[model samples]
Target: MTLHEITYTIKDIQGKGKGLFAARDIKRGECILSEAPLVYVTSNLQEALKSIFVLSKKNAKYFYALCNVHHDISFEFGIMKTNSFPLGQGSTDAAIFRVSSRINHSCDPNVHQSWNPKTKKGHVHASKNIKKGDEILKNYIPILQIQEDRKRLLQENFKFDCRCSACTKPSSERDLIITKVNICTGLVKESAESDPATAIQYVREVLGLLDKIGGICKTSYYYDGYQISAMCSDYSLAQEWANLLLESYQIDE
Candidate 1:
């Protein structure tokens, strides 16, 4: 997707400063935006700073406009630390895209950022149906994490207090969500090999929990559900789940 096709706009989000906001109501599974990075750098900060200075004039201008969350650091390195996301499976490579960087973090985000190595570009997909005025949030940490760990990571790295519903929930309520997430994940791992049938049931539970917990992009779960269904030779169920997974990706295969 290009800038022209993007359905969101950058606007001032209260308490979060600048953020990507949905310009119109967005359907679940819709591609929000996709773009090639302005620059790619090694994990080394010194090299990353050197790399940024050498970017094309236009790219450098755009990069400089991005928010720098770290105030007490070098401006160039600060932006890199503030906005860079991994470009591959390893931490050694990173990429920065103008629009993607503006997306704010939420403990319960409405979007999922995914990297497509084949195209060498990254794309954000709506995790749940988003309203026109809603901010297009991206979770900066793992979704399965408990509230304390999530907030601690954000505080240490981004230097902000997360006030999202999931983060602010009382321990009694928060623990339930954490417990359910762990149960679903553990069930999938344990049953996946020994009991594929049970794995399918566990995957269903996972998808349901994900939807309840604001979707955390649940796309991965649907894919696993499809695979498990196929493994059970339940072609009909496999096709159904495959269709849902495709809808979640909004990809034309």
Candidate 2:
């Protein structure tokens, strides 16, 4: 959606500085906003610095207005580190978007953000139903991390302590579930070849654990299901998982 057509608006949140809030009630899987990056950066500091210097006057203003928590670092690098999102998983390249960068963090976020390579734009979709005027939160770190790791990473990288629902509540139960997910995930990979049936069972366990934690991003797990089913020559189950993988991957598209 264009800036004017966006479903969320930037607003000041108490204690959280600036944040994005739903302009109207949004349904699950609905696209909230999509925009091309205002600045692109690589891993190299000097190259990224050059990219910021070359921004248009208006774009430069927008970039400068973004929050930079890394005050101890170079001004340009600090903004890049704080605001940019990786182009994709394991990608060394990242992009800084004007609107998406404004979304604040939550351990249990109501929205999911994805980079659409085909459209060359970043898209944010409602992971669950969001009410009008509610803050549109997104997970800044891996969703499966325990509370302690989540807090440590946020403090070290973003220079803030999170008080989101996930952080404020008791974490023992949550941590246990996440630990189970990691173990099941490892088992899924290990048994996928030699024991396809067992691998499928582990995949379901992982998905169940993720569901218990309100995670809707299960594309990778579905892909593993598909791969193992196909390995065992179960075309029916493989097709089912393939469809699930496709639907999950296209949620933001």
Candidate 3:
């Protein structure tokens, strides 16, 4: 059986410290990395610290090798704070991986990261065609947040200022798009129960806005459209939305 060759490598990035980079040209939607965590724990400080104690000597060495940007905290906790990724949406727990944690942040990122419950691993996929040697970045915060809010959150949590393409450019245009998406998202929620058709319309609006900025999270919106249509007894449109939702999901898979 042929094995898949690794497509990424860890490299030292100027100003950004260490970063994940493409080792070869990678197509959009390609799975770049799928890795199980070295440590997984609830976000509670004591629980997380205790979890680290059970790490084997080799694994403990690997964990400590990862970066710790928060100098004020104890070394172990600071490393956890800096490198852990949330297990899933709304998850109270997180996982720490060796190479995946080396990925740096960009507001306009080229990769998407998700937790796979079935496989119990974290997956990273290329969201855009990445040239060999290009750094693979992922958005560390919600993509829809405006520039000021993103900056504030990044600085407060991650202790760094992002100068990514999205942040370095004039943010007025992107901020306007973000505002439109937020407005449409609110309308979708508000209208879903009383006006299913209108909710679908707002979902489409959200999808379009996302497409304008690389279609970061369209699966959820497509599912929203499908659910609302089905609830309203619009079988035809519901099926269309369902197919779209599946296709969007499979791309990430």
Please provide, for model 1 over 98-167, each residue's C-alpha lDDT reduced to its tens digit, 9 standing for 90 to 100.
8898898888788888788899888898877899889888877776877777778989999998887787
Q: Lowest-lDDT window of 10 residues in candidate 2?
A: 1-10
Name the best candidate (by TM-score).
2
Q: lDDT by residue for model 3 over 1-253, one digit each (tens)?
A: 2112469878787777788878889998788888899888685778778878988999899898898889998999899888879988888889998778888999988988889989999888887899999999988888789999999999988999989998998999889999999999999999999999889889988988988876776778888999999999999999999898877675554
- Which whole-number lDDT from 0 to 100 does residue 129 have in model 1? 86
Q: Report the poorest 10 consecutive residues by lDDT, candidate 1.
A: 244-253
Cα TM-score per model: 0.85, 0.95, 0.93
The Cα local distance difference test for each model comes to 0.79, 0.88, 0.86
Colliding pairs, model 3: none
Better candidate by lDDT, 1 or 3:
3
| lDDT, candidate 2, 218-243, per-residue tens | 87899899988988889999999999
Candidate 2 residue-wise lDDT at 87: 91
